[model samples]
Target: MQRIDRFTRRSLLKSLGVGAGLLPMLEVEYAQAQVPAPRCAFIFCWPNGMLSTSAATGWPAPSATAAGITFKAFQASLEPLRDDLLLLDGIDYRFLRDSRAPENTGHACNPGMLTGALFKAPGTGTSSIVAGGASIDQYIGSSLVNLGYRGLPSLNLGVFVKSTGRLSWRAAGDAVIPATDPYRVFDEIFKGVPASGGTGTPTPDPTVTRNRSMKKSILDTVRKDLTRFNLRVGTEDRKRIEAHLSSIRALELELDRQAMPPVVVGSKPVLPPGVNTAISENFESTTNMMIDIAVAAMAADVTRVVVLQLGDQGNANVILSTLGYKPAGQVGNTGNFNGHHAIAHRNAADKDKVDTWFQS
Candidate 1:
């Protein structure tokens, strides 16, 4: 597939609708290529740190602290987008230690990172961990002046995460649990999006499934404009655009694969065979699916704000062995050490391997 740059992809996204598979007709002008994609903010909460030990304070990426033009070997995974990345390392989370919230570790750090609010401790009545303020996602998502968009205010998805260490906070005392199930999230975001006469595509409105066909591929939906678009671009550019479209088509198939009609088992509806129902198993695929859905949601203008928390504090909710990384307790390879979180505390060397995968 042709690797499109962020700006180019977004610029093209304004003219494309690959997520919901349906868009309004275009206004019949080449100027649509110049339209900027909907602006979005994505926050990825990694399971834990790359630090040699749990006691480490800041990120070890050299480019983050020392002003540098290149990503170090430690950041090999980000090397592809090195030029596009802004390494603002060493930005202290001082708000975590303010009067309202004192800095803590283990189960407490995730809350204050984005919200700047202290974690409200459990008391006589309230028995859950909650941030005392709205995290940036909700803060900006709710702002009509800033990001008043047509779709959801924010879409939060996760991979194998559990109820604890929730990263997104909707408001004071409201810890927004991320949607860990990708299939459900995909359906909720891409289910209904119809065109109003097919001249130009309307933004994806999750609330509108009234009169639209839910089965047409996005390529089919935009076939008319796509042909027109092909006629205008240079031959080489057209080839590249075609490759990009192929990827979109693949994404469409993937959505369909997982969304197969649910089967009733013992009077209970269960996901189809293709869906990754057990997020903890085949986790690598599950994680990728969630991310793909996230990007598609933003690309389709389903939502302007998306948060993909890699995992919960267990970080153990998902088994790491699927990716070939064994956890700490797998003595002789027949045991069940599911998560790599324990490794970070026990042996930094083993944890470094997991860290490299995340950074890379």
Candidate 2:
């Protein structure tokens, strides 16, 4: 869970030969200096309305919060994932009402989920103000770029949706589109920058090559500049530049890593023929595939940050069948019980059905 904290900038720099045996001395001197370390990706996804009682476990033991949302038996599906998840409750998005749009609008939270901007138009038709700004993923990507991340810093992925909403407002609060297709997304990641040793036919675009060359030129210039400043600047300023150089080199390595194309997760694994894209045929397979992809992205270190929308607003219903609750015969006897959307409605009234659902 805390894998992100395992590596610090100072330690990473020390490993890269910044100073000879100077780390321990510095560590003793300034043990609490705030260093600019690599920020991992933050993934956020809420496809359907959460069945508070069914999805979340209540306060500790028997009587914690007393009357807040609690996890009922129905949340068994999430049990395996609980440790990796933080099930927050009682948090309301009331700040969204500041907009002039009519209050209590349709699927209002969808637009505001990442942007934190109020939707100003009616929710009917395409009348909503859409998202007022870039979503969190986009903001991080843009900031990384400004901080000198030239390669893809963030990845927004979804199925059956345009990449637009993947990005929230970053440039003047506009939407930053997401990348939907795995194939296309993979290509974009490897588009520029040929394979190491210039052995591949995937030649980078001339413009892209020029841009990279220019970046190299700037780094060269900065290195020269730092040399000059070393003679003129104070000791503290020199240390700062050294730190910056260490960070820059780390970033360069990261960029190179990002440039390498990701092989399909199971490329080397033996699989039955015709098993490719099994998740695309229907809901169950697709959800499994999405989860698989998310996990793969993490294991591959392909942008530590990610956000997965199960589906658009009201789209969680689309997955109800996948869970074996709707569309009988679609998933054998398992997926035929009841619609996933109905589970919440049932939980609101009949407790017996819920207990049975969990126990059965």
Clashes of each: 7, 16
Model 2, 9: alpha-carbon shift in Å? Answer: 31
Query: Which runs of model 2 end up more than 4 angstroms from their true locations?
Result: 1-39, 55-87, 104-106, 121-127, 160-167, 171-173, 183-281, 328-360
Error of 1 at 75 (Å): 4.8
Top lDDT: which candidate number? Answer: 1
Model 2, range 74-154, lDDT digits (tens) per residue?
A: 545644444453333343454346555545443545555655554454344433556654455555555666676544555
Alpha-carbon deviation at 259 in model 1, angstroms: 20
